[model samples]
Target: MAMKRNGKSPVSSDTDEKFMFFKDVSLGPHETQLRFRLIHFWEARNPVKKTIIGLEMLLIDEQGTVIQGFIPPGRIKKYLPDLKQGSVYRLNNFYGSKNKPMYRVADHIATVSFTWNSELSVLHEIPTCFDEDRFRFHSYEDFEANCDIKGDLYDVVGHMKLVNGHTLIERPTPDEVKIDTTRHIMVHVQSHDGPVMKLYLWDQAAADFCKKFNSYDNTPTLLLVTAVNTKRLGGTLALTSMSPSRIISTGSAQTRRLLIKQVSADVVTKPWYYIGCSGCHAKATKGATSLVCTNTKCEKINTAGVPQYRAKISVYDNSDQAVFVLLGDAGRVLTGRHASELVSSYFEANGSEGADHLVPVPEALISTIGQTHKFCVKVTQHNFSGDTRAITVTKILSLDTPSPTEASVGNDIAAMSEGATQSGDAVCEPHKGGGVTADEESKRACSSADPETAKRPRCEN
Candidate 1:
């Protein structure tokens, strides 16, 4: 009573017909049925037409071979809503073709496109052995070898040693019609005791990463990035996230163990610098009469610059020694004293209105110098002005030496968590008011205080 599309009857899950693996899929006119788990998927919009083009999916069969799946716009109302990521499904009546190398998100050599005659049904009794493939991870050498070939994706896992806040850039999309102007985070990822690679997270992926990173009470020092496109920018190779990319906040078990081992080992640190710009928390330069923010785009002037405490420390393990910079909030966490309070104390110790009117390094912060602490330092290098070498600290984990003033810890904990509570939800701007540009919004975002000296508390709610 039914027509056999491929010179054979449609096979059901209950039947004994051999299961079709993803690798078996080819550019054939015959109907082939398959059951696969949807690993990841995303909706695409026609940039020129401004209409939906159904969705793109990455699926894996029991054999662990990956294949690209597509649903055309005509079938959107029927299949798009029913399809869920990470679910297994039985499908048939799709056509395969050699994938477009220029737009390949997955490494699959073949792609399947759904047609009007395609059929899909949810599969409840999936084989227990069916699991997502552990991707083939590459190293710096592999990156160097393949970076020139564009549109190829790869996997990387590393310790998030350095995390820069955010930078806005305008990028052209695949169509070259619409430009995506968004914020990107520059993260330095290092493999197991190996070389470091630059990773750039743009738009939503960047927001998600920042949220999980700062919001959690105990953030992860390691991360796993899958489906990263290799790009050579400014004479250096970098990893970038595509639409189907996945960023694991809590890195794999192996990486977590490595990070723990690295942190717990005999790591010693000494305080280096004591003051910085209150807004971005960059090292403040000694101006003619006041401190100037090293960040050139700073909205506030040097004289009006709100003074915040920064700590630079020399870190030494058996292997090597490095200098780390800790901004206001992280410094406060380590010393159990707010930067503003320390600055106020400095003003009190020395007469408030000196020729420079600069706040001296507070005793509370100075005591930390030459002392040892266990810090979760993100290792990144910045040479915007010149090729200066130093290790940058992204976050502070713990202090080996107990706080001298134990009572201050209880008082400081509340103030320290105030900013973190909102970090997961908001963008980098902690105290953001309506602003004109992305750069301006970041500048106007609330920190501890206004640049004006009259402002009492350094940070605003």
Candidate 2:
């Protein structure tokens, strides 16, 4: 007789919940309150059930809290395969590492989620080690042997040992800062073919990885390098060819360029190379353009005589769906796709619903961008002839968010936002395939490229 209370319907807004269940949550020691950006999270049941039943969310945070996000209770027991994939799934439970807290429906075993509770987070990330000739990874030494070692540097994969009990491994969130300045790093790798065999860090975040691996080297606790998808900055792109005395060339500045060579244990990066800009962010290409870093909005153009343009993106509406505002399409000439396609794909890989939930062409999808910073984007410059003037992504360390970005913006806008929450409705930003008005563009890109969500059924028409 009553699905109404205080004039509100039983089901409030999609995110709206009964005030009773909206209990305040707090942070604990050894457990900092973090903003987890859900990636791809899914669950399935036993013999009785057929398809994967639950949602697979990719949740990451800049506060070093990178892993799967909270799984609101009732979700474990009430999942339907046919349910929209991008639909927001939330739950309140103790997030942990390893077996215990995978999924607890009634304070009982969930049986469908990953075996992670407190001690070990799931295998959310893999190290970036691969060959330059092709996108294949050097997960094993054999993989690298096949690649023609053009220079003194060689690509090889093996177990990496971390020494300390609690070492600080860099969290490789897409929006993490790239070491903009060039520096020297120590490394140790076995070189048999004239010191040509180089060591590759599996992922960019693994840059500071130092752990205690049981002598064998296969320990899951041990950092596994060389077998990641090898697609982004952190993905084996920082390959440093080495010599017994000096280090050779560092990798490329282009986004999606995989790392080819690397140092294994304790080799150091040479003096000539710069760390590029912070991850997810971009810098100028040599002899092409030079610019200073700025927020996604109000980005400044420092490069002169070149077609230097910048894009400004913001999270809008009560939902705060992430959106980008590009200044020109010339940048697309370098990336081969239009500004909308490139920008859309960037968010698709980094957004909440990922590429699948991308809005229709010429329509930007309303969703989170990379990690916690919704406005993060990859920027490049081009000549008037449509040739690549330079390619650089512009983003900052997500760890600096909330404190730097939010603290400066103030309460009015922040208070009304979903507060790092994702929505299912597709908010379309009006965009033109060949060039349309900013108002005509939708809020998000199509989800055609999200790695995990491509074939997965999501909330798309």
Candidate 3:
């Protein structure tokens, strides 16, 4: 019943001239024109970094309802100029279909698509309600309350306090034909209010964050991260990025000045123990009388009752206190002994203890308590315990000159490092050559010198 200034209806006498609301777009052929303002626009890309087939658009209507639209790559160029983000447009002759629920961009059950013959016209008037941009941000209290809720995702922005080095993980596909190795990075951050949290990044996100921080300049202290997923582990709430997440900076000159002043303010204290596997240098766990390799891929065991170093120490600076575990290189720097040597010395001194019995803590390990050292730490939730948090040492820094007794230990460490380098092997940060190329059955036949072979004990059945 609506008519333009002219005598006839806008489209036709029989057709409706009133713009269709986003909520009204359903799964059917339609002659109705939809007028909406663009909220977001992006090009979809594949995992291999190829430009995919569709242009994604998030549109909002006057009623405040949001809808998603897709344009095929072939028809994208025709409507490129009018597709400017935040612009208002009236589109007609498009088809609406049910969207894939698994990767739905919006809450709507249906998505609109533009056909080759679709008509689009720019509108100058923008809706006032839809003009203000808003983000669904969660406070530290909200994260604590709903961290265990299924499928709950949040948005958070934090100032970067520390960035840890990269670590690689190899995951086997369902078919098990090849393993995909992914690089992961962790960043420690805090909000202006009071809460501190950790952000984990993978693949391109990890690489990008590291590249920015490691560059000679342009190290941003503040990062605004969106689309975060929460998880409860080892009694702490951990935040990770969802597939659609992004990081932006909100740093200022004042933050940079503060960062320089606090660089050496003695924030996190040193760790006491560095329990590592003699084989892959991954952290090991006590299993009854034996020390089991935590790396699922490594087959090493310590059934010989060799004393396993267990570093679980509480450290506190004036600002904060945290319990951190040192493993691999960080452990080595503190104890000044290789994990294998620690095991050997323990069994040598405790020859009276049966190989199948639980071994006591070695004397060398007990001496490291209360000693101070610089370390790069990452916040992680333990896999088995949801309510407990584990601070993992990623790297170590020597703050002062070594004593004569420490100098002797450093020589031994240097000799071991040299030998490990020649064999393309590393105890801590096992990326050098730790993983086995062969299958599980063939791996058992490998020699003792093989890094993977050390995961198992000689007395094991």
Candidate 4:
């Protein structure tokens, strides 16, 4: 039988064999030929048993109709070798089965299932063309309408506003423990002229996003995610990734900048610094003779502990106020001195009691109480935990000129001068005479067991 080159013409031969369109297929066993392009495919698994169910696929026909396809495990080897994405194929003998009601990827009513006698062959030298791909996008309002329903899965395209609360332009160093534990990337994405929404890319989708995001010289602004499940988290609309989700990012880079006032250092509630493992910079556990790294991926066994700044300060703008946690070099950026310099200077002046000695909040941090600065904050999952109001500040931006590496996403804030001194609920006054003991300081600072909670310089573990 000779196949027709033009898609409009009926594909028939002398024996009256004809090609079937996906829209015309009905629920039943069929011995007909179906021609389509394998858009994408993945292994479907039993969620509970963690066993392979079958090879699931999204196939598109010449008429631009898309439908779900499946290859049973028993016959996978027969067609797996020849199965290639984006290649047109002729599938003979398939059972038309009812489509799943939930998490439906395509709009079809039935699925094309490969049977034992199915003959799958690539259709080469096709003069006619097929649609490259298709997407079903919903606006912020549309997503909110379907939130928590677990209905049909859809695609989303938007410009990433904030990645884990940090500007997308800044590539923060990856934390092994944080990545292993969280295992997700929460991005605030905004569609064209739409409200910003949170999208959680989990597991492989997160990994794929990271890989594609870093592959470019400049950060990509436009993000296209396929097969996302909409959810309502903490009374907020959230979109999460599924097993077959694909991430595609491209466009000019953009940065998310926030302008706020540094009200006062939150010295009474939390510590200003933490003794971190020198190797990985994670909170260290105190050993009998040495400090050990809490990060299991750290190569060092008994790594020396280094004091790192983790100062929490109350910050506010004209409208809202919240606590901001200064991690790593952000303290140095805000203050002219480093945590090590302040700690060493304090110890040098006052005799060393022990490693657990609490260091007072340096005057450098206190001096900036009423200052205003543009900050590039790194928002983490901890911010959404509802336990604390702390937002992680990754970098302190200069008001002069924006960095060449960063581009403005929206309206830029005007430069503001130093504001009047504002008193906060948790203010840190200078420690006079002798520093407080570890037990006294711990009692005052310890609010929650969360590691991100500010406390004095000690081995966290």
lDDT of 3 at 316: 40
**Alpha-carbon local distance difference test for all models:** 0.56, 0.26, 0.52, 0.66
On TM-score, the leading prediction is: 4
lDDT of 3 by residue, 1-461 (tens): 65433232323223435566667677755666777788767676775868676788777876777677888888888887777877878887777777765444466777889886789998785433454232455567877776766454555665555455211112111111111244665666664333457678655556555444444244355556655677775566778765555543335453444433442232222222234456654445679887775555667757222222335444443245465554444556777886558666667877887744433344566455334566544322241244324454545556653323445645654655533431111122223334431111111111122332122111100
Question: What is the descending TM-score order?
Answer: 4, 1, 3, 2
The digit string of per-residue lDDT tens for model 2 on 1-461 reads: 25332332222323443211111211221221122223334343332755444343333322222233333334544433423422322322333322233221111111113222322222234222211211123333443442333322223332211122121142222111232132222232222112112233332222333221222233221122221221212322223322111111121122112221332222222110111122212222334355443213213345221221233333222221222333233223223344444444656666775522323222231111111332223321221123222122222323334433434334533554443311111112212332111211222322111112112111100
RMSD value for candidate 2: 26.6
List ranges where model 1 is wrong by over 4 Å.
1-14, 45-54, 165-182, 252-461
Q: Write the per-residue lDDT of candidate 1 for residues 1-461, one digit (tens) a residue.
A: 25445334443445564346676666644376788888877776776996787688888887787888887777778887778878888887787767767646667777878876878988897754567644656656777777868656777776655566221121111211111344676776665423456789876667667665655444455777777887887766678877667765544466565444543322222222334555655445678887776555557576344444434444543234454455544566778987767666766767746744544345575445334456533221231222323333333545543333435644554555543422110113323432221111122222323222111111200
- lDDT of model 4, residue 155: 84
Return the TM-score for each candidate structure: 0.49, 0.19, 0.40, 0.52
Root mean square deviation (Cα) for candidate 4: 21.6
lDDT for 125 in candidate 1 is 74
Whole-model lDDT for model 1 versus the true structure? 0.56
Work out candidate 1's RMSD over C-alphas: 20.6
